[model samples]
Target: MFRVLALALVLSVSFAGVVPNPATDGDRGEYVTLSVPENTSLGAYTLADGETTVRLPDRTVSGLVALAADPALARNLTDARVVRVPGFPRLANGGETLVLRRNGTVVDRLTYENAPESEVFADGGWRPLGATDFQTATASDVAVSAFALPDAPQRVLAALRGAEERVLLAGYTFSSPRVARVLAAAADRGVRVRVLVEGGPVGGVAVNSARVLGDLAAAGVEVRVFDGPRSRYAYHHAKYAVVDDRALVTSENWKPGGVGGHATRGWGVVLRNPAVADHLAAVHAADSTWRDGVAWSTYRANATFQDGAPATAAYRSDFAAWNGTADASVFVTPEDGHQTTLGVLRNASERLLVQQVHIDDARFLNATLDAARRGVRTRVLLGGAWYVREENRALVERLRTTARDEGLPLRARVVDPRSRFDHLHVKGVVTENAALVGSLNWNHESVVENREVMVQLRGGAVADYYARVFRADWRGGVWRLPLCVLAVTVGIVLGAAGVMWRRVSFSGSGRSGVPRRVPRPPSSR
Candidate 1:
């Protein structure tokens, strides 16, 4: 009947390329149109919900059309090609798949309503729009970018130079001279620059954080020290900044080797959401309150070089926020309770991609393993630097072997330290439709003990952008095993040095009480 034909027309036209119009209320199902192929015709389409199938009209007409199942919906899309489908029973809202068939063969399909909320659809695969996609452009309200090594420094500087108002920075360490000078300059120009640094030592590196802080202080930057007990979290491990109204979170310290120079690989995001910026500012304010906080000069006088920083207050946001069409969720460690990161891994139904500088958390490890066991295709990329502990490598190997035994599609690769950079410092995760980015590392301390910040980005350009980054790093920039064995060799060498020092110390020194060998006077003195 005409109703069947009309319904078919609606099916073909409704989803050709519908994009939500952010100018209107987001949840009202309002949408705009994108150009679809002009010559294409609706051959044969079917809408199926559970057990019912409704055959639509097979039409071969093209050109501008107007469509709406309801009058109100029709009015909103008056400018678009409209097809009036009548008597089409309301499709089940939760589970429905639209199948576009050509000559009885399916050409395209969309399965939606898998989550509790409305999903954003884009020409690019379903994912979130990242800062990189909107940094200098106006495509969307949210944007994100991922920079690795040599490229990161320049982008970071660009962010700093672009700031016009206040700059709030919190880090586990700050040792890059170039970055330091930039902060100084920003402060010199009368920008209210406040820096909160972990008042502790960084692992495996000689920390000159005191010197860095002193230089910034001398330049009029308000510098504060965060020690854990005096602060709230066990360690201030987050590396993030809120400049003007834009926010950036990265998995690198300000050390020259990590974020400034191309010596180590890392990932970062520049967010334009005011909600995110305000939340981070609030975190900075709370962490700045610990009575034990000391001036850079005072802390420097009594500092001992070591890894980790003092505990400080953390920034916790109540809920994930959205900007126009993009969805962003901010999570703070020791508070948000790993909801943002773990939720992505747990909810993955089809694919999961994880790239991290390190991974030792058993919960995260088990989640990935379980996801694979459940038939979800899982890929893991780990850091393969010389300094990477052998145990971490063993952990990855165990996962791979176990998955293989269980007949699961699980694979892992470690980035070659010798390739372009010394290590993979970027920590990120991507599911079928969501992506997570920020300073969070895949470890217990980062999740429960230390302060960390991460953003869970739902479907849009941002998620898509990071998914590409993860894929590239996995395919081109990855190396398989044998590097972990090399790490063991490095560990042995360090152990040998320790043994040699011990031998020399105990050989004849006798705790500095060895009797001096009184010279046997040349036989007849």
Candidate 2:
């Protein structure tokens, strides 16, 4: 029975209007019909069975299906005693009829046979926008905390605070009590706060992840949990903030434990570009269109929210200059594929420095080894927790032997994540001097499942800074340093054999292409 309830809860919360079906008009006449006004009550409704259900609230005298992008309408919706239908892409011919009734009485039967779009009820549906087309809207910002972001957050917060407008932030998780406090403070100052957490139980429903929910609530924040379906293990992990007119986007989730979670480091960017933020906010608006999913009386946010400094304190991005012109040092990783990065390093005339957490794909290993053989010096900084990701252990061991045989200078040292289990979530690729940063993970899963973004930074202080960090890790005697030094020396000597330093350079595209020949005097970028 418990299993069935849990299963039912998980499924119902997966979509919008997720309340269980009412007892039917025959059983309860205290309800109103949607279109026909025959019988409609929050007590019961028909469920699509394993798909979605529209549970009405006892307080709901009627229901409203609004799809326009209106914050006022969206925020005031929860108090309307109405069921917010989850908006989805419908397959039916441009027609969707939304009928509403109060106390078994007909109220409104709005129909749009030619809806611009309709949401096909799925386990998960996006937030609904108003019916009126939402092309453009003015923006106002609010300052939540003492810290500042690059531009978007700053401007958005400014507007919010000045205007005392409502703010809705969407991200994968929200466990930062400090952030929560800031939000709470904002609420205390009379600003409305709402967060659409990916891991919430359902639309404004809470089953688990209560700490996350509670902190925000204590701050006078209004949170709508998006339980739109998909997977119990799945979540809406996108990060963006929708202020009055702008939004913020980046690769960061708002969780305290996540920083050191399982050895994976993360990244985020405060997208100040209005157009970009607007588009992202639009997406957020679309997701919250309906009060969908099964109603969980309560939820517990698995993670905790502790006070802490911003994420940038750990992984920072500083602007650099090239050729006397200051350039923003932005390297984004769009999930997984590294063709662009590989091309840059493939053209390397001198060296390649890599620091990654895991690599289930052997091709990437071969590529690195191949670069060494072509005369370009290749160095690798591996995570100590690679064992946790054993799928690539054999490949790594094989690469070790090949490095010994060809003397192609390939060394690896795992970063001892003693303080954190396996949180080394960074992907850095360098060539002689150029560096790659952003958010791409070097794994088959990253390539296939996750969306990543990255940037190519060439010839500048950032590149040099990356090199310096590499050097410190490579030569520093932390557990993996000695092994790295030996590997570097061996790959260089074996590959180079007797080639003089002055005569050396990458064999192909400035980077040593294969494991066939040894080059000399790698050009120092």
Candidate 3:
């Protein structure tokens, strides 16, 4: 009698939501759902049951189906689709693996366990059966922090202030008075400070780089303009800094909007890794010493302005002390093949989450499409700025067709133009266990013909943090919430739910491709 009651209780609660055994699934076997709204039908979709497979009508079907042990439990899905497969293997109460495929192409592979209590997980956040540990990040020897616009200036300043030794900075443009003042202050303190900015106006647009370069040069900061015409690359568009063995990589220019005053939405990463710092510093050295680069004093003869003011410091930090360990490395283009970023996308077995400013390179787009073809779920959040180039807007249509006609598991969305942030200028990629963050974009010019930099981080607290940030950004933001809010929210949810956690598992092999390599450009501007 007791056994009967217990079985009844389990059955009663099973249909409430997730499968009962949530803990048994292995790391790569993380479960997910392709939510089917009411009355919607997945045309030509099929569900498999052991050696047998059943095909649902090309038309719509209404019902809930579990890839688990009990098919009856599906009746509870008032809003989910029911793919009826007679003789479908019952989902094990302990745990079961379910793979969904279409036309022999894998769609999703989910491993689920029965839950001890009733609850739901949505939008990457969890809610309890009735239930939350919120805490702050403690300082560590090797730490990483992410900063976005309207607040990047504060963090950028903090990074600058924390520098105790030499500072090397390379940017496409340098017009931010706030950042200029900070650089001047660093120089004044007897710290070796050197800067490199673009030498000439790009695409007929007059740049204030010459004036900013002159001011920094006058302030005793070693400043030079990159001689792009003599170099193999078309431009020195990479924006990054190396200070005292710490690396600051960003996808923003050094203007009031880009880094200082936070007038634009951008992404920045601070990595306390000696190897990464050394590599970036080397890149800066190479560009600074380019054969054709003219000293700021010499370039000032063609300046657009006679002078500029010392930049004021407004950068701050809401992040905890730097003390997170990461397996981080620097990847520079026109030197290295920019393989690190491509490798992350090619190796994604389960998912690829990216926020890119533009996508025009065929090879880059092909790699992403190939991953989706192999059953890797892909989501690309694109910037909505009107200036994002017409070619990219067309690429979006191509990607959409690739997903629809080829039945690939891919989705792309343009950010709402009305968001608080001006432009989504972030170039970031998050895989199951790694992340790529930096100034490299997915375009022919960026990957093949221009200088770029990025930090490739694999498995660690830092990678996890990046993945969380990507997920949140994928969901449009309210803008004012600082990074701490995400950390606290997760803590509260976990603390509230007495639920046992399971590890996520992923699987996939890596592929390699050669990007168009350009020799070092000529040495004159």
Per-residue error for 396 in candidate 1, Å, reads: 2.5
Please write out the lDDT profile of model 3 over residues 1-525, one tens digit for every residue: 999966633332112234332332231112223444345455545544344455544555334433333333443321244344434443344444455555565554445444332333433333331111111111234467766654446778778775678889988878877778888999999999999877653642134555555678889999887653334356778889888977888888887767774445566778877766776776677667644466877766655543334334233322332335556666777544446667788989888887888876667777888899999999887877778746556767778987999998998877652334556777888788777777887877777666777767666566566565556556765534456897898677665442322111112223554333333322211
Is 1 or 2 the stronger prediction by TM-score? 1
1-525 per-residue lDDT for model 1 (tens digits): 999976645544334432232122432333322223455555454444346445544455566443234536535433455554443334433445545444555545655543222223445333211100111111234555444443446777777775778899888878777888888998888889999877754453245666677888989998888753324456778888988877777778877766675455666667777777887887777666544355676766766664444222111111122223456666777665466567789999988988887787878888888889888999888887666757558867887788778888999877554344555788888888787777888878777667777767677455666666667666654333356788998778777766765665556734578743443222224
Regions more than 4 Å wrong, model 1: 1-140, 203-207, 228-231, 304-325, 476-525
Q: Sort the predicted structures by lDDT, highest score first.
A: 1, 3, 2
- Stronger candidate by lDDT (2 vs 3): 3
Candidate 3, residue 318: Cα displacement in angstroms equals 11
Against the hidden reference, what TM-scores do the models get?
Answer: 0.59, 0.45, 0.59
Residue 77 accuracy (lDDT) in model 1 = 31
Query: On TM-score, who's better, 2 or 3?
Result: 3
lDDT of 1: 0.63
